[model samples]
Target chain A: MCSTCGCGGEDASTRVTLVDGPQPHEHPHPHDHTHDHATRTVLLEQDILAKNDLLAAANRHRLAERGITAINLMSSPGSGKTTLLERTVTDLGDRRETLVIEGDQETWLDAERIRSTGRKVVQINTGAGCHLDAEMFGRGLTELAPPDGSLVFVENVGNLVCPALFDLGESARVVIISVTEGADKPAKYPYMFRTADLVLLNKVDLLPYVDFDVDLCLDLIRRLRPDVEMLAVSATRGDGLDAWQSWLADH
Target chain B: MHELAITESIVDAIVEKVGDGPVAAVRLEIGRLSGVVTDSIRFCFGLVAAGTGLDGARLDIDEPSGRAYCRDCRREFALDDPIMLCDCGSADLDILAGQELRIVSVEVR
Candidate 1:
């Protein structure tokens, strides 16, 4: 049994109403004996993410049919994800009706940052989970209610591990890595890189000051995800912002 | 740490799948590259399954090695590490498998 939060043999799981659906409920069934007490294995091949995946599929179809392009942004803590969004919002500035869904373990700080740009945004506090699931995205989509042809950016939790397992029904997944951090991040967190449609190598201005090797980083990222597109840019200096912006525009 | 949520998902799926019946055991297929901690999920499962029909149900985890296809060497191999280069020392590769996370069966008496 876990001593912390009593999560081992108790109801320590997080209770969240992030989606509009029937909540898991319990009903007493005395007919549990209908099996004649005979042991039988039920052939049920289902993904553990099946419930979440179904919601994600629905979200994907909904977004596509609505002509809304949603992007899932993932990275480790302090990867400058929010900073890039700030620039994107300010630069795009009326070009696209953008909405943001910020996921965090706790706090409304990221949402506040995006809010500073005067754009529509919502915050999701996982409280216990490490990543935001598709159900949460569905709820966010409903709450945001973005207009047709609008763009949405789902800023996932800071951690890279668990978020990769979840598909939030976004049009594309973008993983951001800063040169200030290890270049081998793609190697260490392969799932994140593998699932990403594009990788934004942020903070390129620090490349010279830092000892990060761009070639090595690209090679490592390719190993985990062949044919993954990458763009080197400094969110602070606005260097290479055109490519990043165009990437969004094209997508 | 997110294993708690993962376990909750497992409990929710099992409950919805088996209905209001006493589940005796559950068989799972966890790919080595699924990035899930089996032990943590096990611990969380015990906690989350207490009130459901899956209470006291034994969990059986089957591991599947991660599979990959190396384009440089034009060879396929099982990936134990994502950064692992091909036999030709090339990082050009495409992952083929080892990302599955699913339940294969559920036993009830």
Candidate 2:
């Protein structure tokens, strides 16, 4: 009999052990064990975007508490967002304190342009990053010195795809599609158009020269986002800017 | 793409949880409105998991349906319809679900 346990009946060669030690416990057997086929459903139940959304919500509350109205401006490169901001700042500088948060992959050129307007401006060079997230916005807000009853504009990196997914705690999201670009922009990038609160058809001065259809573009935008407000303006020539300024005044 | 960044985060999370174990499979719940392109995520998964602890692990995605509630009609309906209309033909509605994005669970040996 074995000396380890009283239940031992035979010698080491004759005795059969049902359970083995922890030596190979890590590697389970490959046999057709009944428990192996048992379906164990686990309710992990967690949101991957929950963390980002929580941060965005907190940022929104902070903006509200500080009496700041935030706007996220999205568009393709060379959509004249900088020019529009320059005109807006020049027009509304005396009425309300305005700040611009410029996001670019590299260079502080846009921020320099806005600074000439004599408004509070902060530039975020994403450094090979495509989009701006809530964390970056939160950090930029501190440096931008967001004042109460002020309007804050976040000019997202010049892309329509990734920025649309990120919520930068902006009260409004405006998508700018210039008339120089194709009129099918609203149709091609439906997700961005659908998510935007407003769409600005910039560079309307080129309407007569370029093969652009304003009505067709408006129709496509309406089909995608029925409630989205739209404005047509030419920042370079200062056409239809009074209406834009009035809209800003009301906001 | 942003999916590359997201996949990096997932890989970091997995390495933290399971050091070097043989991960059998991973199940992810991707919501319809999560704005994550499923194909891009899958492509990113393959690229990010290469030569890592999660090599050869299968990715299973569960795409759940979305729902929206109509404030005018006081009812809930599917979000896939052409129009955001309620039973009473009202157009104003608020999205209620299908905005999820999560790594639900994993099977390891």
**Top-lDDT structure, candidate number:** 1
TM-scores for candidates 1 onward, in order: 0.86, 0.77
DockQ of each model vs. true complex: 0.61, 0.33
> Highest DockQ among the candidates is held by which one?
1
A202-223 per-residue lDDT for model 1 (tens digits): 9999987999989999988887
Which residue runs of candidate 1 sit more than 4 Å off their true CA positions? A1-37, B71-74, B89-96
Say which docking band candidate 1 falls in: medium
The deviation in Å at residue A214 for candidate 2 is 1.3
Instruction: Please report, in order, the local distance difference test score of every candidate based on alpha carbons.
Output: 0.84, 0.76
Report the error of model 2 at residue B91, Å. 7.8
Per-residue lDDT for A127 in model 2? Answer: 90
For model 1 the local lDDT of residue A110 reads: 92
Taking the tens digit of each residue's C-alpha lDDT, what string does model 2 give over B30-78? 7776667788888988888887767877788988777988777688887
Candidate 2, residues A14-127, lDDT tens digits: the string is: 222223222221335676654432222222333454445556877899999988999899998999998998988898857888899999999999999999989888999999
Interface RMSD of each: 2.0, 4.3
